[model samples]
Target: MRYLCLIIAISLSSSAVFATEDMDAKLDNYRSAVGKLMKVLKPELVNAMKSKGPVAAIEVCNTKSPTMTNAVSQETGFVIQRTSLKPRNVSNTPDEWETKVLNQFEDRKAKGESPKKLEFYEIIENDGKRQIRYMKAIPTSKPCTICHGEMIPPPVQAKLKELYPADKAIGFKVGDLRGAFSIIDTITQ
Candidate 1:
Protein backbone atom coordinates (compact mmCIF):
# COMPACT_ATOMS: atom_id res chain seq x y z
CA MET A 1 0.00 0.00 0.00
CA ARG A 2 2.80 2.45 0.84
CA TYR A 3 4.64 1.71 -2.41
CA LEU A 4 1.41 2.12 -4.40
CA CYS A 5 0.72 5.50 -2.80
CA LEU A 6 4.30 6.67 -3.39
CA ILE A 7 4.10 5.66 -7.03
CA ILE A 8 0.81 7.51 -7.46
CA ALA A 9 2.20 10.65 -5.88
CA ILE A 10 5.29 10.51 -8.07
CA SER A 11 3.18 10.15 -11.18
CA LEU A 12 1.03 13.11 -10.30
CA SER A 13 4.02 15.32 -9.49
CA SER A 14 5.81 14.42 -12.70
CA SER A 15 2.67 15.16 -14.72
CA ALA A 16 2.42 18.58 -13.09
CA VAL A 17 6.05 19.34 -13.87
CA PHE A 18 5.64 18.25 -17.48
CA ALA A 19 2.59 20.44 -17.86
CA THR A 20 4.43 23.48 -16.54
CA GLU A 21 7.36 22.86 -18.86
CA ASP A 22 5.06 22.42 -21.83
CA MET A 23 3.27 25.68 -21.08
CA ASP A 24 6.58 27.51 -20.72
CA ALA A 25 7.79 26.22 -24.07
CA LYS A 26 4.59 27.29 -25.76
CA LEU A 27 4.87 30.75 -24.23
CA ASP A 28 8.40 31.15 -25.56
CA ASN A 29 7.37 30.15 -29.05
CA TYR A 30 4.42 32.52 -29.02
CA ARG A 31 6.65 35.35 -27.81
CA SER A 32 9.11 34.67 -30.62
CA ALA A 33 6.36 34.64 -33.22
CA VAL A 34 4.94 37.93 -32.00
CA GLY A 35 8.42 39.43 -31.92
CA LYS A 36 9.04 38.39 -35.52
CA LEU A 37 5.77 39.96 -36.65
CA MET A 38 6.64 43.25 -34.95
CA LYS A 39 10.19 43.27 -36.26
CA VAL A 40 8.99 42.83 -39.83
CA LEU A 41 6.16 45.39 -39.65
CA LYS A 42 7.72 48.22 -37.65
CA PRO A 43 10.39 49.15 -40.19
CA GLU A 44 7.94 49.33 -43.06
CA LEU A 45 5.67 51.56 -41.01
CA VAL A 46 8.47 53.85 -39.92
CA ASN A 47 9.80 54.33 -43.43
CA ALA A 48 6.33 54.99 -44.77
CA MET A 49 5.68 57.57 -42.10
CA LYS A 50 9.04 59.31 -42.57
CA SER A 51 8.99 59.44 -46.37
CA LYS A 52 5.30 59.50 -47.32
CA GLY A 53 3.64 60.67 -44.09
CA PRO A 54 0.83 59.24 -41.97
CA VAL A 55 -1.56 58.82 -44.92
CA ALA A 56 0.90 56.58 -46.70
CA ALA A 57 1.64 54.79 -43.47
CA ILE A 58 -2.06 54.00 -43.17
CA GLU A 59 -1.94 52.55 -46.65
CA VAL A 60 1.00 50.38 -45.68
CA CYS A 61 -0.96 49.07 -42.68
CA ASN A 62 -4.02 48.47 -44.86
CA THR A 63 -2.09 46.54 -47.48
CA LYS A 64 1.13 45.19 -45.98
CA SER A 65 -0.02 44.20 -42.53
CA PRO A 66 -2.17 41.29 -43.65
CA THR A 67 0.43 40.00 -46.06
CA MET A 68 3.10 40.16 -43.36
CA THR A 69 0.91 38.43 -40.81
CA ASN A 70 0.06 35.63 -43.24
CA ALA A 71 3.70 35.16 -44.10
CA VAL A 72 4.59 34.95 -40.42
CA SER A 73 1.81 32.44 -39.83
CA GLN A 74 3.06 30.28 -42.66
CA GLU A 75 6.60 30.44 -41.35
CA THR A 76 5.78 29.86 -37.69
CA GLY A 77 2.85 27.43 -37.97
CA PHE A 78 0.87 29.66 -35.67
CA VAL A 79 -2.34 31.33 -36.76
CA ILE A 80 -1.61 34.91 -35.83
CA GLN A 81 -3.44 38.21 -36.15
CA ARG A 82 -4.03 41.55 -34.49
CA THR A 83 -7.18 42.72 -32.74
CA SER A 84 -8.52 45.62 -30.71
CA LEU A 85 -11.60 47.00 -29.00
CA LYS A 86 -11.58 50.01 -31.33
CA PRO A 87 -10.24 48.57 -34.54
CA ARG A 88 -9.12 50.66 -37.47
CA ASN A 89 -9.73 47.76 -39.81
CA VAL A 90 -13.18 46.29 -39.47
CA SER A 91 -11.78 42.80 -39.65
CA ASN A 92 -9.43 43.51 -36.76
CA THR A 93 -12.33 43.65 -34.34
CA PRO A 94 -12.01 41.20 -31.46
CA ASP A 95 -13.90 37.91 -31.36
CA GLU A 96 -15.67 36.65 -28.23
CA TRP A 97 -12.57 35.20 -26.59
CA GLU A 98 -10.46 38.08 -27.78
CA THR A 99 -13.02 40.55 -26.46
CA LYS A 100 -12.87 39.03 -23.01
CA VAL A 101 -9.07 38.98 -23.07
CA LEU A 102 -8.86 42.56 -24.29
CA ASN A 103 -11.20 43.69 -21.55
CA GLN A 104 -8.99 41.94 -19.02
CA PHE A 105 -5.98 43.68 -20.52
CA GLU A 106 -7.78 47.00 -20.14
CA ASP A 107 -8.45 46.22 -16.52
CA ARG A 108 -4.84 45.36 -15.95
CA LYS A 109 -3.74 48.60 -17.56
CA ALA A 110 -6.21 50.56 -15.45
CA LYS A 111 -4.70 48.98 -12.38
CA GLY A 112 -1.32 50.52 -13.31
CA GLU A 113 0.19 47.56 -15.12
CA SER A 114 2.45 48.67 -17.95
CA PRO A 115 0.73 48.07 -21.26
CA LYS A 116 4.03 47.02 -22.84
CA LYS A 117 4.27 44.16 -20.36
CA LEU A 118 0.67 43.03 -20.75
CA GLU A 119 0.24 39.54 -22.11
CA PHE A 120 -1.84 36.44 -21.51
CA TYR A 121 -1.95 32.84 -22.60
CA GLU A 122 -3.99 29.78 -21.86
CA ILE A 123 -4.92 26.34 -23.06
CA ILE A 124 -8.49 25.92 -24.18
CA GLU A 125 -10.45 23.07 -25.64
CA ASN A 126 -12.54 23.94 -28.69
CA ASP A 127 -14.64 21.46 -30.62
CA GLY A 128 -12.78 18.60 -28.94
CA LYS A 129 -9.36 19.91 -29.90
CA ARG A 130 -6.91 21.49 -27.48
CA GLN A 131 -5.30 24.78 -28.45
CA ILE A 132 -3.05 27.43 -26.95
CA ARG A 133 -3.95 31.08 -27.35
CA TYR A 134 -1.61 33.96 -26.63
CA MET A 135 -1.92 37.73 -26.71
CA LYS A 136 0.67 40.50 -26.30
CA ALA A 137 -0.47 44.04 -25.86
CA ILE A 138 0.65 46.86 -28.12
CA PRO A 139 1.02 50.19 -26.42
CA THR A 140 0.45 53.48 -28.18
CA SER A 141 3.68 55.39 -28.69
CA LYS A 142 4.60 58.93 -29.75
CA PRO A 143 4.83 58.04 -33.43
CA CYS A 144 1.55 56.16 -33.30
CA THR A 145 -0.20 59.43 -32.50
CA ILE A 146 0.44 60.70 -36.00
CA CYS A 147 -2.21 58.32 -37.22
CA HIS A 148 -4.09 57.19 -34.14
CA GLY A 149 -4.16 60.20 -31.83
CA GLU A 150 -7.06 62.45 -30.91
CA MET A 151 -6.17 65.24 -33.33
CA ILE A 152 -5.38 63.66 -36.62
CA PRO A 153 -4.10 65.84 -39.45
CA PRO A 154 -6.77 66.51 -42.08
CA PRO A 155 -5.01 64.52 -44.79
CA VAL A 156 -4.50 61.54 -42.53
CA GLN A 157 -8.12 61.74 -41.42
CA ALA A 158 -9.31 61.91 -45.01
CA LYS A 159 -7.28 58.86 -45.96
CA LEU A 160 -8.46 56.96 -42.88
CA LYS A 161 -12.07 57.80 -43.72
CA GLU A 162 -11.55 56.67 -47.28
CA LEU A 163 -10.19 53.34 -46.16
CA TYR A 164 -12.28 52.76 -43.04
CA PRO A 165 -15.47 54.72 -43.42
CA ALA A 166 -16.75 53.75 -39.99
CA ASP A 167 -13.39 54.09 -38.29
CA LYS A 168 -13.37 54.10 -34.49
CA ALA A 169 -9.63 53.54 -33.84
CA ILE A 170 -8.69 56.96 -32.68
CA GLY A 171 -8.45 59.20 -29.63
CA PHE A 172 -5.55 57.25 -28.24
CA LYS A 173 -2.79 58.70 -26.10
CA VAL A 174 0.77 57.56 -25.65
CA GLY A 175 1.02 54.71 -23.13
CA ASP A 176 -2.53 53.52 -23.88
CA LEU A 177 -3.05 49.92 -24.88
CA ARG A 178 -3.70 50.06 -28.62
CA GLY A 179 -4.40 46.38 -29.11
CA ALA A 180 -2.59 43.05 -29.17
CA PHE A 181 -0.86 40.54 -31.34
CA SER A 182 -2.78 37.29 -30.97
CA ILE A 183 -1.55 33.82 -31.81
CA ILE A 184 -3.32 30.48 -31.67
CA ASP A 185 -2.04 26.99 -32.32
CA THR A 186 -3.31 23.49 -31.91
CA ILE A 187 -1.58 21.59 -29.13
CA THR A 188 -0.52 18.17 -30.23
CA GLN A 189 -0.57 15.98 -27.19
Candidate 2:
Protein backbone atom coordinates (compact mmCIF):
# COMPACT_ATOMS: atom_id res chain seq x y z
CA MET A 1 0.00 0.00 0.00
CA ARG A 2 2.85 2.40 0.88
CA TYR A 3 4.65 1.57 -2.35
CA LEU A 4 1.46 2.23 -4.32
CA CYS A 5 1.12 5.63 -2.64
CA LEU A 6 4.74 6.41 -3.41
CA ILE A 7 4.24 5.46 -7.05
CA ILE A 8 1.24 7.74 -7.31
CA ALA A 9 3.21 10.65 -5.79
CA ILE A 10 6.05 10.17 -8.24
CA SER A 11 3.63 10.00 -11.14
CA LEU A 12 1.96 13.23 -10.11
CA SER A 13 5.30 14.96 -9.67
CA SER A 14 6.50 13.83 -13.07
CA SER A 15 3.27 14.96 -14.67
CA ALA A 16 3.63 18.42 -13.13
CA VAL A 17 7.19 18.69 -14.43
CA PHE A 18 6.09 17.64 -17.89
CA ALA A 19 3.26 20.16 -17.85
CA THR A 20 5.66 22.96 -16.87
CA GLU A 21 8.09 22.03 -19.62
CA ASP A 22 5.30 21.95 -22.18
CA MET A 23 4.13 25.42 -21.11
CA ASP A 24 7.68 26.74 -21.38
CA ALA A 25 8.01 25.38 -24.90
CA LYS A 26 4.75 26.97 -25.94
CA LEU A 27 5.83 30.33 -24.47
CA ASP A 28 9.09 30.13 -26.38
CA ASN A 29 7.24 29.58 -29.65
CA TYR A 30 5.01 32.58 -28.97
CA ARG A 31 8.06 34.73 -28.22
CA SER A 32 9.65 33.75 -31.52
CA ALA A 33 6.50 34.62 -33.43
CA VAL A 34 6.26 38.02 -31.76
CA GLY A 35 9.95 38.65 -32.43
CA LYS A 36 9.49 37.97 -36.13
CA LEU A 37 6.57 40.37 -36.28
CA MET A 38 8.62 43.10 -34.56
CA LYS A 39 11.56 42.60 -36.89
CA VAL A 40 9.26 43.24 -39.84
CA LEU A 41 7.61 46.28 -38.26
CA LYS A 42 10.72 48.07 -36.95
CA PRO A 43 12.63 48.48 -40.22
CA GLU A 44 9.57 49.64 -42.12
CA LEU A 45 8.77 52.17 -39.41
CA VAL A 46 12.34 53.46 -39.26
CA ASN A 47 12.57 53.93 -43.02
CA ALA A 48 9.24 55.68 -43.12
CA MET A 49 10.28 58.05 -40.34
CA LYS A 50 13.58 58.76 -42.07
CA SER A 51 12.09 59.37 -45.52
CA LYS A 52 8.89 61.28 -44.73
CA GLY A 53 8.40 61.86 -40.98
CA PRO A 54 6.32 60.74 -38.02
CA VAL A 55 3.16 61.08 -40.09
CA ALA A 56 4.44 58.59 -42.61
CA ALA A 57 5.64 56.32 -39.87
CA ILE A 58 2.18 56.42 -38.35
CA GLU A 59 0.77 55.43 -41.71
CA VAL A 60 3.15 52.51 -41.88
CA CYS A 61 2.00 51.42 -38.42
CA ASN A 62 -1.63 51.79 -39.36
CA THR A 63 -1.41 49.95 -42.66
CA LYS A 64 1.53 47.58 -42.51
CA SER A 65 1.53 46.47 -38.90
CA PRO A 66 -1.60 44.40 -39.26
CA THR A 67 -0.45 42.91 -42.55
CA MET A 68 2.85 41.86 -41.02
CA THR A 69 1.10 40.42 -38.00
CA ASN A 70 -1.24 38.43 -40.21
CA ALA A 71 1.59 37.05 -42.30
CA VAL A 72 3.47 35.99 -39.19
CA SER A 73 0.35 34.44 -37.72
CA GLN A 74 -0.21 32.45 -40.88
CA GLU A 75 3.35 31.19 -40.82
CA THR A 76 3.23 30.30 -37.12
CA GLY A 77 -0.35 29.04 -36.83
CA PHE A 78 -1.03 31.50 -34.04
CA VAL A 79 -3.36 34.45 -33.68
CA ILE A 80 -1.27 37.60 -33.20
CA GLN A 81 -2.32 41.18 -32.51
CA ARG A 82 -1.46 44.38 -30.70
CA THR A 83 -3.62 45.83 -27.94
CA SER A 84 -3.39 48.69 -25.49
CA LEU A 85 -4.99 49.79 -22.27
CA LYS A 86 -5.75 53.04 -24.02
CA PRO A 87 -5.94 52.27 -27.72
CA ARG A 88 -5.43 54.60 -30.66
CA ASN A 89 -7.36 52.35 -33.00
CA VAL A 90 -10.75 51.27 -31.72
CA SER A 91 -10.02 47.84 -33.15
CA ASN A 92 -7.01 47.54 -30.87
CA THR A 93 -9.04 47.73 -27.67
CA PRO A 94 -8.13 45.10 -25.15
CA ASP A 95 -10.49 42.24 -24.45
CA GLU A 96 -11.24 41.14 -20.87
CA TRP A 97 -8.22 38.88 -20.46
CA GLU A 98 -6.00 41.36 -22.18
CA THR A 99 -7.25 44.22 -20.06
CA LYS A 100 -6.52 42.32 -16.89
CA VAL A 101 -3.03 41.50 -18.09
CA LEU A 102 -2.41 45.07 -19.14
CA ASN A 103 -3.44 46.33 -15.75
CA GLN A 104 -1.07 43.88 -14.13
CA PHE A 105 1.68 45.10 -16.39
CA GLU A 106 0.97 48.65 -15.30
CA ASP A 107 1.22 47.59 -11.69
CA ARG A 108 4.54 45.92 -12.40
CA LYS A 109 5.77 49.07 -14.10
CA ALA A 110 4.68 51.18 -11.14
CA LYS A 111 6.76 48.90 -8.96
CA GLY A 112 9.84 49.77 -11.05
CA GLU A 113 9.94 46.76 -13.31
CA SER A 114 11.28 47.39 -16.79
CA PRO A 115 8.41 47.46 -19.24
CA LYS A 116 10.67 46.44 -22.12
CA LYS A 117 11.29 43.08 -20.49
CA LEU A 118 7.77 42.53 -19.28
CA GLU A 119 6.06 39.41 -20.58
CA PHE A 120 3.38 37.03 -19.46
CA TYR A 121 2.11 33.65 -20.65
CA GLU A 122 -0.40 31.10 -19.56
CA ILE A 123 -2.32 28.07 -20.72
CA ILE A 124 -6.05 28.57 -20.49
CA GLU A 125 -8.88 26.11 -20.90
CA ASN A 126 -11.91 27.72 -22.44
CA ASP A 127 -14.95 25.76 -23.48
CA GLY A 128 -12.91 22.55 -23.44
CA LYS A 129 -10.28 24.03 -25.72
CA ARG A 130 -6.76 24.58 -24.45
CA GLN A 131 -5.00 27.69 -25.67
CA ILE A 132 -1.65 29.22 -24.89
CA ARG A 133 -1.67 33.01 -24.60
CA TYR A 134 1.38 35.26 -24.46
CA MET A 135 1.92 39.00 -24.17
CA LYS A 136 5.11 41.06 -24.50
CA ALA A 137 5.10 44.70 -23.49
CA ILE A 138 6.17 47.41 -25.95
CA PRO A 139 8.06 50.20 -24.24
CA THR A 140 7.97 53.69 -25.65
CA SER A 141 11.23 54.78 -27.27
CA LYS A 142 12.55 58.11 -28.61
CA PRO A 143 11.18 57.63 -32.12
CA CYS A 144 7.83 56.65 -30.69
CA THR A 145 7.58 60.04 -28.99
CA ILE A 146 7.29 61.86 -32.30
CA CYS A 147 3.77 60.51 -32.64
CA HIS A 148 2.79 59.15 -29.25
CA GLY A 149 4.32 61.68 -26.87
CA GLU A 150 2.77 64.36 -24.69
CA MET A 151 3.71 67.16 -27.03
CA ILE A 152 3.07 66.31 -30.66
CA PRO A 153 3.84 68.85 -33.39
CA PRO A 154 0.78 70.50 -34.90
CA PRO A 155 1.02 68.75 -38.24
CA VAL A 156 1.57 65.38 -36.66
CA GLN A 157 -1.34 66.03 -34.30
CA ALA A 158 -3.53 67.00 -37.21
CA LYS A 159 -2.63 63.85 -39.08
CA LEU A 160 -3.23 61.72 -36.01
CA LYS A 161 -6.62 63.30 -35.41
CA GLU A 162 -7.51 62.72 -39.02
CA LEU A 163 -6.48 59.08 -38.79
CA TYR A 164 -7.71 58.29 -35.30
CA PRO A 165 -10.31 60.70 -34.02
CA ALA A 166 -10.72 58.89 -30.73
CA ASP A 167 -7.05 58.20 -30.13
CA LYS A 168 -6.12 57.71 -26.46
CA ALA A 169 -2.62 56.42 -27.25
CA ILE A 170 -0.82 59.70 -26.69
CA GLY A 171 0.99 61.14 -23.63
CA PHE A 172 3.41 58.28 -23.33
CA LYS A 173 6.95 58.98 -22.11
CA VAL A 174 10.08 57.04 -22.80
CA GLY A 175 10.16 53.71 -20.96
CA ASP A 176 6.40 53.71 -20.52
CA LEU A 177 4.45 50.68 -21.66
CA ARG A 178 2.85 51.63 -24.96
CA GLY A 179 1.03 48.38 -25.51
CA ALA A 180 1.81 44.71 -26.10
CA PHE A 181 1.97 42.05 -28.77
CA SER A 182 -0.59 39.38 -27.96
CA ILE A 183 -0.25 35.85 -29.30
CA ILE A 184 -2.62 32.98 -28.85
CA ASP A 185 -1.88 29.45 -30.02
CA THR A 186 -4.51 26.77 -29.73
CA ILE A 187 -3.22 23.51 -28.33
CA THR A 188 -4.84 20.39 -29.65
CA GLN A 189 -4.76 17.59 -27.17
Candidate 3:
Protein backbone atom coordinates (compact mmCIF):
# COMPACT_ATOMS: atom_id res chain seq x y z
CA MET A 1 0.00 0.00 0.00
CA ARG A 2 1.89 3.10 1.19
CA TYR A 3 5.15 1.13 1.37
CA LEU A 4 4.78 -0.08 -2.22
CA CYS A 5 4.19 3.49 -3.44
CA LEU A 6 7.34 4.71 -1.69
CA ILE A 7 9.41 1.93 -3.28
CA ILE A 8 8.17 2.79 -6.74
CA ALA A 9 8.99 6.50 -6.24
CA ILE A 10 12.54 5.76 -5.16
CA SER A 11 13.07 3.37 -8.04
CA LEU A 12 11.85 5.85 -10.63
CA SER A 13 13.92 8.70 -9.20
CA SER A 14 17.05 6.56 -9.07
CA SER A 15 16.62 5.58 -12.72
CA ALA A 16 16.32 9.25 -13.71
CA VAL A 17 19.51 10.06 -11.83
CA PHE A 18 21.32 7.22 -13.57
CA ALA A 19 20.13 8.47 -16.95
CA THR A 20 21.47 11.97 -16.22
CA GLU A 21 24.83 10.59 -15.12
CA ASP A 22 25.09 8.57 -18.29
CA MET A 23 24.47 11.67 -20.39
CA ASP A 24 27.18 13.53 -18.48
CA ALA A 25 29.67 10.76 -19.20
CA LYS A 26 28.86 10.81 -22.89
CA LEU A 27 29.21 14.59 -23.03
CA ASP A 28 32.63 14.40 -21.38
CA ASN A 29 33.84 11.91 -23.93
CA TYR A 30 32.59 13.99 -26.84
CA ARG A 31 34.25 17.15 -25.49
CA SER A 32 37.56 15.36 -25.08
CA ALA A 33 37.48 14.11 -28.66
CA VAL A 34 36.88 17.62 -30.01
CA GLY A 35 39.68 19.04 -27.84
CA LYS A 36 42.14 16.45 -29.12
CA LEU A 37 41.34 17.28 -32.73
CA MET A 38 41.73 21.03 -32.21
CA LYS A 39 45.02 20.44 -30.40
CA VAL A 40 46.44 18.37 -33.23
CA LEU A 41 45.33 20.69 -36.00
CA LYS A 42 45.69 24.22 -34.56
CA PRO A 43 49.47 24.25 -34.22
CA GLU A 44 49.99 23.21 -37.80
CA LEU A 45 47.59 25.84 -39.02
CA VAL A 46 49.30 28.53 -36.99
CA ASN A 47 52.73 27.63 -38.33
CA ALA A 48 51.49 27.49 -41.90
CA MET A 49 49.88 30.91 -41.58
CA LYS A 50 52.96 32.43 -39.92
CA SER A 51 55.66 31.18 -42.29
CA LYS A 52 54.11 30.32 -45.63
CA GLY A 53 50.98 32.51 -45.55
CA PRO A 54 47.28 31.97 -46.17
CA VAL A 55 47.76 30.18 -49.48
CA ALA A 56 49.96 27.69 -47.71
CA ALA A 57 47.35 27.47 -44.96
CA ILE A 58 44.89 26.54 -47.64
CA GLU A 59 47.22 23.70 -48.56
CA VAL A 60 47.20 22.63 -44.94
CA CYS A 61 43.41 22.48 -44.96
CA ASN A 62 43.40 20.63 -48.25
CA THR A 63 46.16 18.14 -47.55
CA LYS A 64 46.73 17.85 -43.84
CA SER A 65 43.27 18.22 -42.34
CA PRO A 66 41.77 14.95 -43.60
CA THR A 67 44.72 12.85 -42.47
CA MET A 68 44.72 14.52 -39.07
CA THR A 69 40.97 14.12 -38.73
CA ASN A 70 41.17 10.39 -39.47
CA ALA A 71 43.97 9.91 -36.98
CA VAL A 72 42.03 11.72 -34.28
CA SER A 73 38.92 9.71 -35.06
CA GLN A 74 40.88 6.50 -34.65
CA GLU A 75 42.45 7.69 -31.42
CA THR A 76 39.10 8.67 -29.95
CA GLY A 77 37.01 5.80 -31.40
CA PHE A 78 34.45 8.24 -32.70
CA VAL A 79 33.50 9.43 -36.16
CA ILE A 80 34.17 13.16 -35.95
CA GLN A 81 34.64 15.96 -38.44
CA ARG A 82 33.63 19.47 -39.40
CA THR A 83 30.61 20.27 -41.50
CA SER A 84 28.86 23.43 -42.65
CA LEU A 85 25.79 24.69 -44.38
CA LYS A 86 28.15 26.27 -46.90
CA PRO A 87 30.96 23.78 -47.03
CA ARG A 88 34.31 24.48 -48.61
CA ASN A 89 34.74 20.77 -49.13
CA VAL A 90 31.96 19.07 -50.97
CA SER A 91 32.46 15.98 -48.85
CA ASN A 92 31.64 17.99 -45.71
CA THR A 93 28.09 18.70 -46.74
CA PRO A 94 25.93 17.99 -43.69
CA ASP A 95 23.59 15.01 -43.58
CA GLU A 96 19.93 15.44 -42.71
CA TRP A 97 20.44 15.36 -38.96
CA GLU A 98 23.45 17.60 -39.07
CA THR A 99 21.58 20.05 -41.26
CA LYS A 100 18.82 20.23 -38.71
CA VAL A 101 21.24 20.89 -35.88
CA LEU A 102 23.15 23.49 -37.85
CA ASN A 103 19.91 25.35 -38.48
CA GLN A 104 19.06 25.17 -34.81
CA PHE A 105 22.49 26.53 -33.97
CA GLU A 106 21.80 29.45 -36.28
CA ASP A 107 18.49 30.08 -34.61
CA ARG A 108 20.08 30.02 -31.19
CA LYS A 109 22.81 32.40 -32.31
CA ALA A 110 20.14 34.74 -33.60
CA LYS A 111 18.66 34.80 -30.11
CA GLY A 112 21.96 36.08 -28.60
CA GLU A 113 23.70 32.83 -27.74
CA SER A 114 27.46 32.97 -27.84
CA PRO A 115 28.81 30.87 -30.66
CA LYS A 116 31.45 29.33 -28.43
CA LYS A 117 28.76 28.37 -25.93
CA LEU A 118 26.52 26.75 -28.49
CA GLU A 119 26.29 22.96 -28.42
CA PHE A 120 23.64 20.31 -28.87
CA TYR A 121 23.34 16.54 -28.57
CA GLU A 122 20.77 13.81 -28.80
CA ILE A 123 20.60 10.05 -28.41
CA ILE A 124 18.46 8.84 -31.26
CA GLU A 125 17.04 5.41 -31.98
CA ASN A 126 16.78 4.80 -35.68
CA ASP A 127 15.85 1.51 -37.31
CA GLY A 128 16.63 -0.38 -34.12
CA LYS A 129 20.08 1.19 -33.69
CA ARG A 130 21.00 3.84 -31.16
CA GLN A 131 23.28 6.75 -31.97
CA ILE A 132 24.57 9.74 -30.03
CA ARG A 133 25.01 12.79 -32.24
CA TYR A 134 26.60 16.01 -31.04
CA MET A 135 27.68 19.33 -32.51
CA LYS A 136 29.58 22.37 -31.22
CA ALA A 137 29.43 25.65 -33.00
CA ILE A 138 32.58 26.93 -34.72
CA PRO A 139 32.88 30.66 -34.43
CA THR A 140 34.58 32.62 -37.16
CA SER A 141 37.62 34.43 -35.85
CA LYS A 142 39.93 37.09 -37.29
CA PRO A 143 42.70 34.68 -38.23
CA CYS A 144 40.28 32.46 -40.10
CA THR A 145 39.23 35.50 -42.07
CA ILE A 146 42.37 35.33 -44.15
CA CYS A 147 41.01 32.22 -45.81
CA HIS A 148 37.31 32.19 -45.05
CA GLY A 149 36.48 35.88 -44.83
CA GLU A 150 34.38 38.08 -47.04
CA MET A 151 37.42 39.82 -48.55
CA ILE A 152 39.95 37.29 -49.69
CA PRO A 153 43.26 38.08 -51.29
CA PRO A 154 43.29 37.32 -54.99
CA PRO A 155 46.07 34.78 -54.59
CA VAL A 156 44.31 33.07 -51.74
CA GLN A 157 41.05 33.11 -53.66
CA ALA A 158 42.73 31.62 -56.70
CA LYS A 159 44.32 28.90 -54.65
CA LEU A 160 40.98 28.13 -53.04
CA LYS A 161 39.29 27.93 -56.42
CA GLU A 162 41.96 25.62 -57.68
CA LEU A 163 41.73 23.40 -54.66
CA TYR A 164 37.97 23.46 -54.15
CA PRO A 165 36.05 24.03 -57.31
CA ALA A 166 32.75 24.60 -55.57
CA ASP A 167 33.84 26.38 -52.41
CA LYS A 168 31.07 28.24 -50.60
CA ALA A 169 32.79 28.67 -47.25
CA ILE A 170 33.72 32.27 -47.72
CA GLY A 171 31.80 35.43 -46.81
CA PHE A 172 31.84 34.91 -43.07
CA LYS A 173 32.31 37.79 -40.63
CA VAL A 174 34.01 37.64 -37.27
CA GLY A 175 31.81 36.02 -34.63
CA ASP A 176 29.59 34.46 -37.26
CA LEU A 177 28.65 30.78 -37.44
CA ARG A 178 31.49 29.31 -39.47
CA GLY A 179 30.34 25.72 -39.13
CA ALA A 180 30.50 23.02 -36.48
CA PHE A 181 32.49 20.09 -35.22
CA SER A 182 30.17 17.10 -35.39
CA ILE A 183 30.48 13.79 -33.56
CA ILE A 184 28.60 10.51 -33.94
CA ASP A 185 28.80 7.46 -31.70
CA THR A 186 26.94 4.19 -32.11
CA ILE A 187 25.61 2.73 -28.90
CA THR A 188 25.09 -1.02 -28.57
CA GLN A 189 23.11 -2.38 -25.69
Off by over 4 Å in 1: 1-18
Local accuracy of candidate 1 as per-residue lDDT tens digits, 1-189: 999999999999854543777788878888888888888788889999999878778878898999999988999888999999999989998988899999999999999998989999877778877778899999998888888899999999998898899788999999998899988888654
Estimate every model's Cα lDDT from 0 to 1.
0.88, 0.87, 0.88
How well does model 2 score by local distance difference test?
A: 0.87
Q: List the residue pairs that clash in candidate 2.
A: none
Residue pairs with backbone atoms closer than 3 Å in model 1 (clashes): none
TM-score of each prediction: 0.88, 0.87, 0.87
Per residue, candidate 3 scores C-alpha lDDT tens digits across 1-189 of 999999999999854543777889989988887877777777888899999888878878887988888887798787889999999999999999999999999999999999988899987766676778899888888888888998999999998998899999999999999999999887753
Every candidate's CA RMSD: 2.8, 2.9, 3.3
For model 2, state the Cα shift of residue 109 in Å. Answer: 1.4
TM value for model 2:
0.87
lDDT of 2 at 121: 77
TM-score of 3: 0.87
